[model samples]
Target chain A: MSNAGLDSAYDVAAVRQDFPILDKPLPGGMPLVYLDNGATVQKPRSVIEKLVECYENYNANVHRGIHSLGDQVTTELEAAREKVRALLGADEVEEILFTSGTTMSINLVANAWGRKFLRAGDELLLNEMEHHANLVPWQQIAHERGAKLRFIPLTADGRLDLTALDDVLTDRTKLVAVTAMSNVLGTINPIGEIAARAHARGALVLVDAAQSVPHGLVNVNDPRVDFFAFSGHKVYGPTGIGVLYGRRKILEAMDPFLCGGNMIRRVRKESSDFAELPSKFEAGTIPIAQAIGLGAAIDYVQGLGFEAIAAHEHQLTARAFDQLQQIPGLQIVGPGLAHRGSIVSFTVEGVHPHDMAELLDRKGVAVRAGHHCTMPLHEWLGVTATTRASFALYNTHAEIDALCEAIQYARQVFRRK
Target chain B: MSDDLYDDYILDHYESPYHRGHLEQPTIAHEDDNPLCGDRVHLELLVDEHDRIKEAWFDGHGCAISQASASILMKDIEGKTLDELRDFQAKQMLDLLKVRLTAARQKCGLLSFKVLKTMVYTLDERKGAMSPTQGGRG
Candidate 1:
């Protein structure tokens, strides 16, 4: 799967056929050029069929029922867990716990682990480029425990100034939470290196893989990541289902965040015992159909192969960078294509992001605009908001060209004023 | 190139906003920010003894629709009484902008008017002024 042949073998047209939404037209009968993959990706037909199959056939609650449909659903749910484990290259299926989404996963760690372990004067190291999902949870824990929140500043080119890592990670540092890929700047952080540095100082690392896991390879057993989390919707899977992969020992030691029915082992008159490993974290009846759909998504992505997906997205991003750079007043916010993921966020001088996004929408180019849930990062960059066009495997070079033309048209519309 | 959303007047006020500055020793002042998009608006109104708004100013950064609508609102509010400002509805701002916005963009276009309405309501609440009918304009 990691071979060079897979990279050259990518056929985007064939890939686009699997996603039915690619053929849909906009309100004005223009072909839709969806470039908002960072927010969420359109699901493939295989994934959609899997969801229908789950509901149309074996629609039952898992883990407790002894009936035939329940047994089948429980088996499917566990199989989905195994698929997620294999996706993260984890050793055991028990390490993967399904939550609602990435936000829930991070909050599980922050409350279950941080509230129990972190004390006053402790340091929680995070980067400035993190989405509010990653930043706010840590901020809450730090505030609750009287711990100090430290940041790894971004460089002039929108990269983590890792030169300050040594100063940031101290013996008092309890955890280091960072995004594997920035949602706004598109800069892919060196998670392994950051994890290694944090581990050397006896600090645990949590990688927010909501952006990277969908686009490239993410191995939970990489020795640097003690915990990892991602959303199903971001990875071309169904929404309302996400994964939190934690090392077994750490999960065994931490307290449960949500206490309810499915997560409890036994209940006494005044006391109760919690379930084991992953079940201890999964409180309610899980998102059964969504998890199965996520399994189908993982199968689709693995079938296409990570190497091919990365190569295809790299080509699209490179071409977009080249063409978008030619537009006057269009300043790209992140690093060059070499260090970025499939996202390209930029600002057009004298044009507001909302205006550009609206104009681009009229031309059937779907993009994202605003702070992108990274207000601190935008403030650090001295911009209120930026218009971002993020790519996926189903995207084509022609779509990139269309995006460039739409941007030029938006500039013309603004200049007319 | 005239889309229904961004007309010449909206772009003009966006490029050159009127009364976009701070007011000294204002009678009523408040600021609010849209954290989702980072659009902020700080408004100040100078009220005379007759309860007329002698001057109105706003300072913030946002999209063209917001800035332009704020500029239009600045011109509309000058020399009006506090009651008149309170009776100003969000629909009036939308009509003035002359654009049909999506549900999301509608928030951006009406943000300034909402901020001003909040400021006036706060003033009424503080001074025990304005009956329910006058202060209840949305």
Candidate 2:
């Protein structure tokens, strides 16, 4: 059970005890082998307890009321923002804006920033491996403003082919939006390098940290990064809450995404002035308890530290990659184990992904199948769908073994037909 | 017993589909795709002068459940009349699959039936063949 050369202080068995859901049994009395972390992570007892405490104690509107409950809620909410600020290694707390999740966070930038600065004939750069969340909003912006949308093509091995960066990052390109890590491929993109290249062309960069933020360290104040976004649910926090980090100067200059309630400074019929910094973008009553839960989740992850988490996850990925390669017809997608994150997307020959996922589910091995919201990437890779088994801090080598066994069983069952 | 949703018979139909091609000239044709899973089906019917389906064929790519369901549907409606096809319900198609499906997979199992119903409905609308009540089955 001990991962050699890793930080041995980080005991995964102790970590698994924190998450109550990991102990629950699936149908047929089989132990649940949850390998679907790329979709969303299971919450720990600390996050759940924090959410319940917030609701049971100080359940009130934040930032508006002067009452004791309101004050308590507002304090906790701002404290949550500070937690996110620290999590991202952001320079100032004012740079963090709370939203629903990663989808809304990207939409906020596309609407508030892209609409204002991008002009007709200007280009919006994106990667082929972007989730629908990061692609659709820009697609809408391009349609509305008569702007052009370009993609940084993927190499044969699924990494971003940056050889054409000089031609792609033209002066006409206003923004370079890319994922820090691909959710499907598990390819950890060179965000710092991409940001540096884009910034040299006077273009801003938006990092979709939905997958990367939860797995490892992220410093948003890297000068090259202008906007960064991630979700709470994917990081073992409660749903309905996420964070969007923007550079202070850029956020101060842009318009608000939503025009209502707390986001407005003064409203008189037609003309209105927006609030400053974070509140300028936060419209209406935000996810109060969810935000507090996110704060507790951050505390939990930080307690474990990224170094331990990364070491453990890398071990799991390498074990999985080696075992999966032993299968006769299984084709592991994305980069090699060295460059890949914890996610492992693959396809078994002559077996549809849906069948494989269903068969695996019967064995209490939960995984995601199909396009994984990256249809363009699948098309580029010459696959309609792939079966993805992503890992988390709580997952064990035993669970990876179960996944491989279930996959082999699925292949056997399909081949019988 | 191991997830009967992928029964051997279903896999057999999936591996070798029945009537799985387009007619040279068809009286009615319809194609629909399930965007969620990328399952697509194209149902074509060649009707005779007596309003009977002389030939029926389906072509598409999907999961085993979907492809098998389409193959089963092609066998079910080969010689049936347009009226019989119009009155066909989704329950009948699910019955043919003979396996309980999750809500998401239910859509996959019934995609071919939906495409066929749509083709019949479109033909009814164009020719003013069936009334609203008669063409209400799907």
True contacts kept of each: 0.83, 0.43
List-wise, what DockQ does each model earn? Answer: 0.74, 0.60
Which regions of candidate 1 are displaced past 4 Å? A1-8, B1-3, B23-25, B122-138
In model 1 chain A, the worst 10-residue window by lDDT is A1-10
Worst 10 residues of 2 chain B by lDDT: B129-138
Clashes of each: 0, 0
Docking verdict class for candidate 1: medium
Candidate 1 local lDDT, residue A85: 92
List ranges where model 2 is wrong by over 4 Å.
A1-9, B1-3, B129-138
- Give the alpha carbon lDDT tens digit for every residue of A1-417 in model 1: 122223444677777788888887766899889999999999999999999999999999999888999999999999999999998999889999999999999999999999999999999999889999999999999999999999987889999999988888899999999999999989998887888888989999999999998787589877448899999999989999999999999999999999888899998989999999789999989899999999999999999998888888888898899999999989999897778999999999888898899899999999999999998898899998999999998888788889999999998888832
lDDT by residue for model 2 over B13-36, one digit each (tens)? 888889998899999888998887
- What tens digits encode model 1's per-residue C-alpha lDDT throughout B1-138? 234787788888888888999888899888787778877788899988888888989998888887888888888889889898788887787887877777888788888899889988887776664466566434
Q: How close is candidate 1 to the true structure, as a TM-score?
A: 0.94
Question: How would you encode candidate 2's per-residue C-alpha lDDT over A1-417 as one tens digit per residue?
Answer: 334334544888788899998888886898899999999999999999999999999999999889999999999999999999888888899999999999999999999998898899999999889999999999999999999999887888999999978777899999999999999999999888898989988999999999998887478876459999999999989999988999999998898888888998898987998888889999898998999999999999999998788888888898899999999889999998777889999998888898889899999999999999998898888888899999999888888889999998998888742
